[model samples]
Target: MENKDSKSEMIKSMAFRLFLDRGYDATTIRMLSRAAGVEAPSIYHYFGSKKGLFYAISESYLEDYQELLKESMKHWGADPMNQILGFVKFAVWYTMNHIDETKFYLRYRLFWPAELSEDMEKHFHKTNDQKEDLLRDAIRVCIETGSCKVDEQTAYRSLINFVDSCTFNIIFSNWRPDEQELIETWQLFYQSRIKLGKGDFEL
Candidate 1:
């Protein structure tokens, strides 16, 4: 069982590196096998096909994001604003730690085989929408408690869209810099836009 787990992990690590370094289309079983130090046919034995491998990579990345978000939500029992901030921190931290995974997903989400990409998107968006719904529920509670003054769904959607744009831009902006600068500037940006209400803070 331990060897099986190790081999499986080796396959996934090699597959991720190959898919990122070589475009998915340019990567082949023989090449992956060579890089992974396995026999040419061994990759198929592990992953079934290149498509399956890509899907697994995509799923693994998305699952990491989902798990982080869920973990962040643990502190947010009944507060909308806190819930939103928890999500923001999770997005920032996860993207910072898993930069390669973010790069792999953002680059290849729509580039690989169409069917596989579509299926991957479907699964990702389902989890994404579930997270948004949780945020929306918190928004509804806030509205009921008079803590915020906006339509619940609109606040939820607006906040989510803004955060999603920031998260993706931070990951794929091509502005390579110190992670501290990136995270600090982004946190500042979020504070100005989403955390502070419109006209709530001075530049």
Candidate 2:
């Protein structure tokens, strides 16, 4: 017999897989229960309802990604270039390793969340701010070290937008060129747009 915690984990894992395979709308409780190898009521026992299961799945992604960001920050005393590269690699590995979770996050957390309550939306926004702040800190480090000359806030926002565009291409890699080529393109784009003033600019 599985422990309650084990049962809850099973429900969440099965629900996530089913969500990826069948989509959030198409995945039914019965189907999820069958995949979890438990009775339908058992799923309700653990998750309360289908909406509860969906919330668990959505929140799990945010929590896990936030944890990753926190962990990265713990070791981020390095240069901005290394920090950005490390983050890029981590993001790629994370997205590839947790494709289902990434898809759910992209769908519900990032893009479509019409059914989510305002509180839930605010929760995601707040949680996302943690990671965004970390990235900003990295850019600030660059500015302080004279490696970058852009305004901290504007540079951070631009970096995030650029990274998101790159990540979106990776997410849709089926239509994208090779990862190396994509990353190279991003490097050139960033270098040209984000000048490394190296203490030369007076303004």
The parts of candidate 1 lying over 4 Å away from their true place are 110-112, 146-153, 172-203
Per-residue lDDT for 70-178 in model 2, tens only?
6875675567766776676567667666666777677665554345556466767867777677677787888888766788876776667666665675578642445
Candidates in order have lDDT scores of: 0.69, 0.71
Model 2 misplaced regions, further than 4 Å: 144-146, 174-186, 196-203
lDDT of 1: 0.69
| TM-scores of the models, in the order given | 0.75, 0.76
What is the C-alpha lDDT profile of model 1 across 5-55, one tens digit per residue? 688678889989988888787888888888878886667776788887777
In candidate 2, position 181 carries an lDDT of 65
Clashing pairs in 1: none
